[model samples]
Target: MTNYHDPIKHLNFLRQTLSLDKKPIGFFVSAGCPLSVEMPKGEWPLIPDVAGLTQYATQELGSKDEEPYNDYDRLLKEVVKSEKDPKNIEDILSFIRSLKVVAVGNDVRGFNIDALSEIEKNICEKIVEKLDVDLPSENSPYHKLAHWISIDRSVPVEIFTTNYDLLMEQAFEDISIPYFDGFIGSRQSFFDLRAVEDDLMPDHWTRLWKIHGSINWFQKENKDVFRTTRTDEINSSHLIYPSHLKYDQSRKMPYLALIDKLSKFIRKPNSLMIMTGYSFNDEHLNDTILNALKSNPNTMVIAMLFGDLTYKDDNGDVIENYPNAVKLARNRSNLAIWGKDEAIIGTVRGHWHTMDDDFDDSINLANSITFVQKEGEDGEETDEKIYSLNLGDFSKLGEFLQALIGYNQTNFDEN
Candidate 1:
């Protein structure tokens, strides 16, 4: 019946991975990163998440009356009515792309390829417009991450992100950090598959792989994918939204290659992957990670969720947070799910339990995890058996990293 997970023990394991300079450390940052950024004076996120972007795209597309808009409107209505699961603009785009690779082709909604192309372009441009905003300041979380990467290490740091925004790149450049994103040549940076495959770059140079296509990426008439600093110059039709639909060409693009890189990175011995701001929403990626875990027993994946592992429902039922992820972690010894108030490590799913004497190294360790009160059936407050973990949010995670580097530790106890 004793089912509490020790945060101190789990974090010590994490510290070992981070402390060892020779170990290969990687980060999988997803949509929550941008959303976690604080906007000045209660402004919205620098860029909207998928749901927010979907809402924005819906409003923008619905406002227009042109041929493309009409086609998009019809397609949206039909797609939503029939499928009922196209959650965001990316999912919608993935659906459209799936249609392309199918036998039906552009004949699904009585629309041709040209109309589909137009619809994709409209959504992509809107997304780019929304994501083009610059970082808030040098003290941002991303900049902190950049600082973390800048630390002395024998093995190169690999950062894999599914976002199309340039925030990560901006963070690296802001600190004069040398990094490569699988692009080579001058102004029009063409993707060098060999460079990505070989990874001959120095250890100091970070490898930034954007698994999802970026705003700077575009396709030429020759079907060559190239990147540029100018987002406005690129066409959205070329962006890769890899879904279940498989094709020979897509397997060769940066999507497959970057995904393969993830698999390869995890397969390496002693490799540790820290996932932040990522839910198990991406089933394809979920499969990739789980399969990798099965293949490599020596590696570890620590997923940091933005919420607690369990919540009280209206029926007073304890609902697990991101159940699929938790389930996967329970089955895989190498995979750890780190939530706000609890964690699942080595097939043990439970809340954090720690004592005051657990703080040996830094006082900030006490700041990250704490104990909250509980109530009894008589409506009186009772003692709780566990602690509340708060390292899921990117802001707190960044402060933890800063505290590790001796930059700042005061924020760990603050907001």
Candidate 2:
């Protein structure tokens, strides 16, 4: 069968053809990306306290507590049932959005591990495992790309991620791959400054821009000063939760300055962008991305569309076929799609099957589908067959990155 996971071969091919050095290439990751490695089975892992707030809100709303019921839950139930008025639904969503992190924390804390049904407990355990484990070095596509870029090209790479998880950061660290995300600083004044001085920054490392903030990031005092990841107890006040208004709130000076810096990076001429596991749901993020694309016509975007590549609207009609795939296809003049048919196999497959029906489980299932096709002698057609680990699987991540590097090197040679 054809191996779809062969990223190196593909990279070599692209390098032989494309003019890469004329442009800078970047990779953007969203939280939904399945960049994580398999976690070992374990007991209740410590859920971040930020997730506990969700449970607190749920219990407070459900019980006859002294805390005033904002009718948030009732409105949510109504909204789900489609019985609530549009305005009421909007208001309820607004409230829920505001309380998301708190609500997530509370939800985790509320789960009675001992009392849970086997399947339910398994689901919770899986999420905990996913949260705790670092991204697998061998399987992570991002790292693979980083390795290729580091070895093949002289051009600097910029990594922009919206995930709060440390998977990407851990990958870079594990490989001794230097990176900057505006969080690192000197020991003497580290506690005071928000970012490392431009002069002290290394030339070879990737510059990471955590657009949606990070789990390890926190604010200090009332000032706009920030802190990097630490081994000590997490300060609950520092975590930035994902919400609809997050981008708006970030528009305040400090965040605005960061965004300005990030924007300039993207606006640079001949920039190629590759996006993975991003759902394109955040309007503010979408606007920024669209603006960047519009600003540079030579820019190219390669997006991976995961899952069934289909969707249904309110009326239960398939108004948009291949919703995720199609939306991505329409967005850019120069774009390539991947991950429509790549599946996780071996031990990872077994692990996913053991998990309960939850977000993590669903993600695992989605990651299990692989790309397949058939070929025949000469130009003749034959029965189509599914190909595994060809150019689309996680294993090919490094190869893909290498291909970009090769392409860039070719351009450099030509010039």
Candidate 3:
């Protein structure tokens, strides 16, 4: 029987085999869930001024008074109708746009936080409350991983996130982990001067690529700057709100060049991409990932599926083919799927204080080791566990990163 229960042993074995120090791994975070806290309305908290306007609108619409706009279905319609003049309509629409509700995709339509309506804000507030109850801060995982990787790897790790929030930056600052984002160095420069200069490669500093514009990212005076703290003195033009492709256009040449850089980085050989909490909904983003896989077939993708792996077919029947969904099937061999149940099992005790204690981390570790061994045995019955764990338990985040680093090191050294 293959003894897969010992995580330390498994990690050490993999590290010895892969020589992980030679090649670096890349992390791509999907803003929806894995690294992001899901807000009910899909809305991120903007600067205080914008937030105040939103609160005012919500309160004026009877949200604070708990009065229905007009029953339930007609609430939004009534509000729109209340603005008889075109200017009033424009003002309302502008306020609605300022709320930055478009950030939430179509998937959350039925939820109370659907779009950027008052209902959505209320829902998001509740979620935030729940989150506050469990974790002291959102930067917990980011800081932990950043610190761990910095100490373990020779090369600074690269983090690419599609989120528009400052959570990641906040985490880095809280931990005092220095990071170099594509933004922040220059405002008016059309090209990434940092990319051209060797100074960009500062020693022991992580590269944080915000693929999408951040909440604090704004263009002004023909330049872009990302600010984390609030500032009322800044001009209205300097406020970076959640926007669509237009935001990308606003960056002009710099944004395009950054995307190209990211594309090249992802295509590197022996590179492992760890994706968490992304739904693979954005076609353009998906294309980038697909292209990366094509460029390097040997690349490994470890995806954490928060829920079941099943998807419905066109006929509305649930299908067993999970990780095999059309968009993901192309690189099936390198794909690893972890669900919620499995996450609890795979997590390390005391590493994450938020997860339920009832779940067996040891059993999950044993199972994962067994699954890897079984895959290597060509279907032969080995004393290894073949079951995979779920990806729900947040604590598993640390363990996953650790295992991945170990696995990469082992594979690198063996080759």
Q: Is candidate 1 or candidate 2 better by lDDT?
A: 1
lDDT of 2: 0.47
Tens digit of lDDT per residue, candidate 3, span 166-272? 65666677767887776443333233545623337665777787665444544555454444334443343323222233333445344454566567666767676
lDDT of all predictions, in order shown? 0.79, 0.47, 0.47
True lDDT of residue 381, candidate 2: 55
User: Model 1, poorest ten-residue lDDT window?
Assistant: 406-415
**Per-prediction TM-score to the true structure, in the order listed:** 0.91, 0.59, 0.57
lDDT of 1: 0.79
Off by over 4 Å in 3: 1-19, 34-139, 184-193, 196-199, 223-230, 237-250, 311-316, 319-326, 330-337, 340-386, 391-394, 402-414
**CA RMSD, predictions in order:** 4.4, 12.0, 11.5
For model 2 the TM-score comes to 0.59
Clashing pairs in 1: 340-389
At residue 382, give the lDDT of candidate 2: 63
Per-residue lDDT for 312-365 in model 1, tens only?
999999997798898788799999988877788888877678665346656445
